[model samples]
Target: MRNRAPRSRPLRAVFAALTLVAGTMFGLAVSAPAHALGNGLALTPQMGWNDWNAFGCNVSEALVKQTADIIVSSGMKDAGYQYVNIDDCWMTGSRDGGGNLVPDPAKFPDGISGTAAYVHGKGLKLGIYESAGTATCAGYPGSLNHEQADANSFAAWGVDYLKYDNCNNQGISAQTRYTAMRNALANTGRPIVYSLCNWGQESVWTWGAGVGNSWRTTGDISANYTSMLSIFHSNVSLAQYAGPGGWNDPDMLEVGNGMSFTEDRSELSLWAEMAAPLISGTDLRSATPATLSLYTNKDVVAVDQDSLGKQGTEIASAGGADVLAKPLANGDVAVVLFNENASAQTISTTASAIGISSASSYTLNNLWSHVLTSTTGTISASVPGHGSVMYRVSHGSGSSTGTTHPLIGASSNRCLDVSNGSTTPGTQLEIWDCNGGSNQAYTLTAAGELRTLNGTLCLDANGQGTTAGTKVITWNCNGQSNQKWNVNPDGSISGAQSGLCLDVTGGNVPAGNVNGTLIELWGCNGGANQQWRLG
Candidate 1:
């Protein structure tokens, strides 16, 4: 859930002392480089089973044990699925006398430690959830100010992964609250993979790598094509922010949650293509053969677990047809042709467009059909609606052409301007009448920066700000994260530093189309103000 108003909690004397010591010891402004936490966890997107989508608050010790047993027996363990996570409501509504979370006796008779041991015995890790607020989404006692005590409790319980959620956060900056937990987890001397669940607000991806192993890039996903497609579009653009030890999570896999079989396959394919964490949110004990097959497809799972850790790029997207290509470690590329229409559509792209070099011929290995075919250069497929076709291409060749184009706002139909056509650094960006001037022509480079002014000035976030409404300016090309941009498939461009959209200021208003509307970074709301097209 997104940030909500936190409930008032009466501070106990003992908990106060503990909080004071924690704040003094681990609170001296925790910061890290733009890389991951560097604890050597989550080198690739995490593969696991989480219980929120299928079971909700109905989790119990028996259910968790049975799921772990089934994962091993059903070949999922061999296919790379590991963690078995318990979601919210695992604890009682209140804390104990020591200000520690207490597992519900009815649900976890042997406590969380017992469950963790049982899962560990099966050669799998255990995960648990907690909110960063005074109360969880289900109204259970949360870790808000008690982050230290809670971290200790989880470590003592042998927990291997932590899913920290956003609920009743009291409007605190996500950076401050999440950083506290990251510090607390480090203090415990245990290796716990932290997963940030802030629903993508505050551009978490901009700094999530320095804090946690994975961060959600959108709102929760439902089991339908529309929700999946929307989340996919939101996440597919943030590829530059994802790599080893950190990822852009698009929420869990809703494979068996009532979507059609084709839609389920597409969800898995797109998630794999995006290098997203593959946490199955379904009841494994009752999963059908097809659902299990979708979860345990070694070929598709290999694409997700590829060592290159490069998130797929959108080669071409038009109408309801989309093409995505992810480069693998072995000089091979994984390609997907997806159709989002109501019927069937043919999608096509060349090997060169996907960053492959020319060769005598290209070998295409169909991931789903397990069939082999040869292509001289073009990769095309007639895909069913709500379905996808994925392939592993080997020994292919292609080249990319660089082009500069004008970025037009979807709402105002104006050009992105450099504010008086200044060449100086820190000249704030704006929207003006589209005259096709050099100021409006920006070239998106393979390194992910948007360069203009004859490739001298790159689009940058002023002061390296990671919050919404930050000034968007032009700076000298420096190859920094603040200057990187992701041109998304939904006609929106987002900053690699902030993960926020390049929005026309006040563009949601009636007078937003004036000749000189300033542009800034803001939360992506799917509004016309945040949408842009390049041509």
Candidate 2:
């Protein structure tokens, strides 16, 4: 939400001398029950432009208007990027005498209503911002004690979305505070997309769906490769907490900012696969054709807008290669093969292993290339380092059925071979040449658990380590949180404990083949050490 943009706010007493720094917004009214409010605003992740990441407190009506115009004239509006959000710094230094928030006339001389009208005329919606706390992050007035007046003001202004941030919030229940805004929005008799920006405090994912249309699952996103990938890894595992209407936001897009071309593609592709919001955080008024093209890539957009709201699951991760699978309503599955390693990688997985239908053959359509091919239940690709490839696969007319097999590594060309034939808790996992050993066989259950079918043990993130480079081991099944796992659509398996991904220690060619190099948890760096191919 910032150039170091402040996060959304929390409820608290107003502060003195409110400094100014802008955050973000999308709609005015209407709401969701963590179930995306069933209100029909962001049925798919909301696509729009947010100002915080680009301009911060420098936001002005002129900039917003020009941005909205560019969104339409550049074909972004036609491509479904319709919301023109005004993040922070749009409010006056003080509210009106009626205790209502006021727009700063110096910045918005025609006022919010005029801006809203102008945006709506272009077939776009207007969004406003407020903090749950007494002050927004930059010290601007917040909604802590003025939820109703604020909501009323926004509705009257024809605001279509509301980005509620949490800053300056005195210690209070996030549930209670966020619910206050939720109820307030509902009372307005208008449809607003409620976005909760609590920065993951209180595991917002757990209760956010019942309150807001989308909840930020991470901290702010910077315009760089590491920050973007870091957020992606953090949010992907929380997919289960989101459903129709409610989404888990991984922060805004950084595609047009500063990352490499390949990295930008990976960013866009991964966000689409995850079903997260696609709010642009760039200077759209000066965007290049390449930037606009990346924003409007039809194939990527289609998979993201697919009616099926299910977020993709990470099917496999080892040595920096991951596969995430999103089931589409069209009986097709959208798969993204991502290589997070420094070098290019050739990864593969079977339709059945990734949770697609067990049909004998699958017809593959490259979403990026539009290339069509028929596979007999197997999908493979050579993904560039730090880049990704996406495809839509449907059941083919061929007669082969899907099969289950061991996960094989690319660099080592070894199976997810176990260190020993033991099924006890604490058994070490390693990559060894394929031998069809019973130990090498594992199952990714619908419950998001990777288990030894015959052994009855679940893969566990040792000690529930949340930091990068934790140890992963086997444990007896217990319904505890740490034992749960998520197969992200990026081909990485993230544990429920810390949401850190599975990694191959010293993940290199020959060293990775050694029986026990300590397969551990690590920050998902997209290295080959975290990649695996399901046979």
Candidate 3:
């Protein structure tokens, strides 16, 4: 990652450069090895239970112990669910006699040490939380000026994990603050998995591996399908930043928190396929068996914990049907057919495009149903709305080209269609379901023209507006700067002329309100509404 905030100060710049050199020396030594740091911890994504997504500020010692007990009794412990994390609001408003943050006596009557002992007794790890700022997200005491004392206190309490947050820090450099906690944790001599939760500020993925075991790559996730879709789309575009010891956390799993089963499957499969942390974000003590079944699906977890530790690449994405392929340690490939469409549709992909090159016939193991089948060329499945089908595809050659296609938003099950299918210049684009119309089709040419299949129209910024909120439309194929868009590696489509991003207007809109939301050019802010995948 970019040497993380190089500056004019010679000493600080050298330290930053040294940190970069240390990670680089090893990083280049192995050609993207599974363990970038060789940190001996989080060899795969951290498997755990987090309180905030499930219970928020209502966390208590009893609740955490009960969760630990349920995790043990439900056989989730054997399934690789390890840590039971107490997120924000677990601490008091102030610190203790030694200036160490304190757990609220009333809520955590036995305090953090007792809670950690109880969790550890059940063969589970304990995770504690604090902020890099003066106060946490819930306004609790933070470790801004007391990183060493707080880290030492956590170690004394036998904590096994740490989630360092960022909130109300007066805009201190995130790199400096997070590096402070990293050094603090290291100085404690206790091996705790560090989780950086700064809401992906300063593009944390660019420099996070050196600071923590895993880092959040997006905003928090809600118990809504749109939130999951947004986070999934964002995480898929960041596959290069993760490995064995470090991961790109798109928040935690919301499987049992009232989203649809299809969406839950998408969340589980996408996270596993992408090698994201599988931290359960549900009230485990009261969760139903069905929910645990989804969470502890052995086959899906198998893909996530694979020794290869390679985050799956989006081999194919088009027409709202996406294909993700991850190479496993056993020479087989794990492929996921992700359908972000409103209706169930048959999506297919060939094994060669996914990088499997060996045998003539490959056996497919269904991660969900345990169904086994064989395919000679293409594997296909009927994926449901907002759902996915994952398979372990074996025996195929790795020599083929993948064609990219257009991806439409799932909230409305629509394509990026032209206004009334008009060929006229200045015809604005709108969302409509895919009917294979020529106006709805687009080809991302090597020269950056999003050309229609009919070969007449190209995407253009309306009226040559160079400001935010400029609507984009289809116009005659003229080679002008306004018609060129860079499909960015960060999953954004930026205008070559204005340097703005093609964005969806509704910022975090309520479910079902995304239809007809104007597509405009805005300053690139890396919002989920602005992210796009070239299919």
Which whole-number lDDT from 0 to 100 does residue 223 have in model 3? 91
Query: For candidate 1, what is the TM-score?
Result: 0.69
Cα lDDT tens digits for candidate 1, 1-535: 3234333221322243344346558875423237758988999999999988988889999999999999999899999999999999899988999999999999999999999999999999999999988899888998999999999999999999999998878888888999999999999999999999987777677789999999987777888779999889878877878999999999999998888767887899999999999999999998755477678778999999999999998878899799999999999999999998878677889888899777878987767644456789888876767778898899843221146778777566678999878999999999888897889988878898889988889999999998998999999999999999876543467898888999888886548757888889999764557766554
In model 3, state the lDDT of residue 204: 73
Go through the candidates in order and give the clash count of each: 7, 69, 10
Clash count (model 2, backbone only): 69
Pull out the clashing pairs in model 3.
Answer: 317-535, 356-396, 357-396, 357-397, 357-398, 358-396, 404-535, 405-535, 414-432, 415-432
| Runs off by more than 4 Å, candidate 2 | 3-36, 397-535
Q: Model 2, 231-275: lDDT tens per residue?
A: 887777766766778888999898778776568778999999999
Off by over 4 Å in 3: 1-38, 396-535
Candidates in order have lDDT scores of 0.84, 0.76, 0.77
| Model 3 C-alpha lDDT per residue in residues 1-535, reported as the tens digit of each score | 0011123333542343355457666774322224344457998899989988867789899999999999888778888999999988887777778787888899999999999999999989999888888888788887897899999999999999999887767668988998898888889989999988877666677778877889887667889898898878777867887887898888888987988655776789999999999999888887754466567677789899998888998988899899999999999899999988888688898877888885678888767644456778788886666778888887743211123355453233346777667888777776665677787777776577888747678899998888998989888888888899875433357899999987767633434225566678899754445544332
